[model samples]
Target: MTELGYRHGEQHTPPPARRVTDVAVERFEHVFEVDPRLMTVHVAQQLFPNWDTLRIAAGRADHLDWMHRHWAHTVVSGQELLDDITGADADGPPGGP
Candidate 1:
């Protein structure tokens, strides 16, 4: 584990705790569908590289920080794409204007 908080063979320093901001609170508001485990998994994909899905999001501030830095972009983009697809899917086939 390094300052980034990834698991590995040798010992390393863990990153500092993440602090909550109003922006994060606002962004996360109404985003109940995304699983907290997903955050750790996604952050692992980006920042932690070789990590697995065993990390927890509740007490680990480094994971949350990495998630904010890296995962948020993917989440927002994915949500936007899903929203577009959902909107289109909800509409019936186009009739002649």
Candidate 2:
């Protein structure tokens, strides 16, 4: 028997739950055409003010740490934003062009 009362060979595994960051990344990428993995803190703060508020209210330190790790090493540029806004060619950089 398992913790959930299932037999040893009949344990049921639940489907993986999507993380909040995953959804945020997907939406941010879809709208901005940028790899959200490379988003800067300023950009993330601007784009996800609601998420920030929720994190603070919920006291989700883990989520806050995950967000920091998500955008730890990259910076967004003006030219990249312009390219995305103007529908320019897609050859600028890893996250945008």
Candidate 3:
């Protein structure tokens, strides 16, 4: 009879622990509601490709510093466009006038 190599009691490396920040918690509350495991370190890294742990823990992180660098420009552009629309509306003649 051939011996089996697989063991049912084998132990595996545990996943890294996650400590979500207040900002992340607030923004991702709904994500947590839907998937409580979304706050894991691995998931955070996957979602935020360019995140810098050092910066986050050191309190020197900028608004967009630890975010995915690829999305930075897109977010900024969108915000700028929104601001432009707001400004245009504010400058236009009053609707009831």
Candidate 4:
């Protein structure tokens, strides 16, 4: 018997549970041109805290690539926060002031 208290000849393996998360992480790669799996979840979360879209929007070209790969249009803000396609350093908060 193991820690799970499984007896001999008995398959104690539990079934695979659904991947549930409340932090709202991106799951799909919208940019089909590029491979999404290239970036791992750890790196994504590390580079982008809470999978923040603003970081991706204001980051380098590669970061932008990550954004698209993670389904930017759906996972994050649903293509609503994109105010300026052109990356510009503006004062005050994003889309404000």
Q: Which residues of candidate 3, in runs, are more than 4 Å off?
A: 1-76, 93-97
lDDT tens digits by residue: candidate 4, 1-97: 6487535333332222233343223332321111224456645523223234333444665776797888666545535456443333454555765
Best by TM-score: 1
> Per-model C-alpha lDDT, please?
0.43, 0.47, 0.44, 0.41
Question: In candidate 2, what are the lDDT values of residues 21-87, reduced to their tens digit?
Answer: 5334222212222444557665752343434434454565577567768976765678988878666
Give TM per candidate.
0.22, 0.17, 0.20, 0.16
Ten-residue region with minimum lDDT total, candidate 4:
27-36
Clash totals in order: 0, 0, 0, 1
Q: Write the per-residue lDDT of candidate 3 for residues 1-97, one digit (tens) a residue.
A: 9887644333232123344553333222222222335556554523321123333434543545667464555445678878877877888844534
Clashing pairs in 1: none
Q: Which stretches of model 2 miss by more than 4 angstroms?
A: 1-65, 77-97
| lDDT (Cα, 0-100) at 34 in candidate 3 | 21
Better of 2 and 4 by lDDT: 2
TM-score of model number 2: 0.17
Maximum-lDDT candidate: 2
Reference-based lDDT, residue 42, model 1: 44
Model 3 local distance difference test score: 0.44
